[model samples]
Target: MSTETDVDGGDTGDSLTLALAQLHVDAGEVEANVERALAAVSRAADRGADLVALPELFNVGYFAFDLYARNAEPFGGETFTRLREAAADHGIAVLAGSIVEDLAATESVETPAADGFSNTAALFDADGERRLVYRKHHLFGYESAESELLVPGETLETATIGGMTVGVTTCYDLRFPELYRRLVDAGAELILVPSAWPYPRIEHWQTLSRARAIENQAYVATINGSGEFEEATLLGRSSVYDPWGVPLASSGDEATLITTEIDPRTVVDVRDEFPALRDRRR
Candidate 1:
């Protein structure tokens, strides 16, 4: 009775069904936000999503700068535990990241700051296994306190799932092409970006995401939140771009799920046909 079906109904054994859980995050409301995210996960699984990505700081909405310290969690904290369990129960991979991680309070992992908090993302496979942890390498300093409050991460790593190598990067990191290049070099075929991009910068979001996909020859998915903060409102234009920079699936300014199918071989095919990555001198 499982609703899961292979992407495109082809036994390609390569295509992956991805879902973007674009939730309307309410600032300072941890329980309410987590409940919504859990509901979205169930919905995505019912729609046959093999992987569902939650937005950055979905637990404690990104713009809630004053509440960050109050909600900072450890490596295997409650919010992550619930999502991990949901991943296992529903048989879907979950990218539960960009939480305010209490680095000094975590266990069984090496923290970058040792005594501070960080914007961290964790990838959990369908089996509820921790695949990789990506800390937001770039902290936004544009009239924001993110850079002043949290510690930047130094780890750059990738994990494997659905016959493809997956890499992770958070918001603000999108502005740096070099990071994408590094991920490409590390054999990443699918890169997940969890963001809280605000309004008026829609053009920057679209252009940067597509450019990363085009240049890296990899599938790039940007999962953004939807909600208004005291000083800003999220853009909520979550999208998935193929290796050729074409948007396979997208959404507008709303709390919704954007799902799409991407074949790993498409990456192989595109990179083979274009041969642009081969021309890189840097």
Candidate 2:
């Protein structure tokens, strides 16, 4: 187990490496997308990444709203099963990004509805076991049908991995700080935000990500897709931020892998030095 030092020169014991797969996704191309995703994971594992994260709705394009219902599948369906196998084979954990979940066939842990759909994220452990699932709570309604087609999630999910507590949240949820606060209160030292955010909002994406890390004093890894859809082109500035709001790694619009070392102890050190979280008032 090799290790790396943090920004402050602290020894990062049991440091975890991450590979953010910024892949170009074609709408309605599930088979090709899955193969790309699996290949990314394998490459990450070859580089000794402890975990790999994909962007939101990579299976079915985020802008391909018309194909949602058709592509929607139950949790642990073929896509998820293959990803789970990939995780097991690669000997790494995977954050299989947002899927167009069939709400009728799926039973959400927080918000259980009889019918409709959801933007969901699934986490698989290195052992190929399902660890956590998070449905998107904040749906984009400004210029989209997300709010109309999907019901918002009602629960916050966290998992213990690589000597840290990691929380899960989707794309639009990044804009809401209150949700992140809840995650912090739930003992989340790191948060994975799988996003499908398009162009014209690059500033918002970067700003909000740093804000979340700064305010919570935690690691915020925002993994975004690098593809363009018929309706929009995704801003592929996928980034990873440390507790001090430093951009550890970032990517441009091309589909590529961005790897970084994350020290679980850095979160504690930053909170001790800054102590903003402790000073928060009601």
**What local lDDT does model 2 show for residue 151?**
84
**Tens-digit per-residue lDDT, 1-282, candidate 2:** 111111121224579887798878888998888888898889889878889999999988898899999999888578888999999988899999989888788654533654788898989999998888899999999889889888888777899877779999999898889999999999999999998999998899999999999999999999988777778889888888999999888888778788888998899999999898899889
Clash numbers, per candidate:
1, 0
Off by over 4 Å in 1: 1-14
lDDT of 1 by residue, 19-134 (tens): 88888899999998999889888988998889999999999999999999999999888999999999999999999957999988897754564679999998999999989899
Name the lDDT value of residue 266 in candidate 2.
93
The TM-scores of all predictions, comma-separated, are 0.94, 0.93
Identify the runs in model 2 with alpha carbons over 4 angstroms from their true place: 1-14, 107-111
The lDDT values for all models are 0.89, 0.86
Predict model 1's lDDT versus the native: 0.89
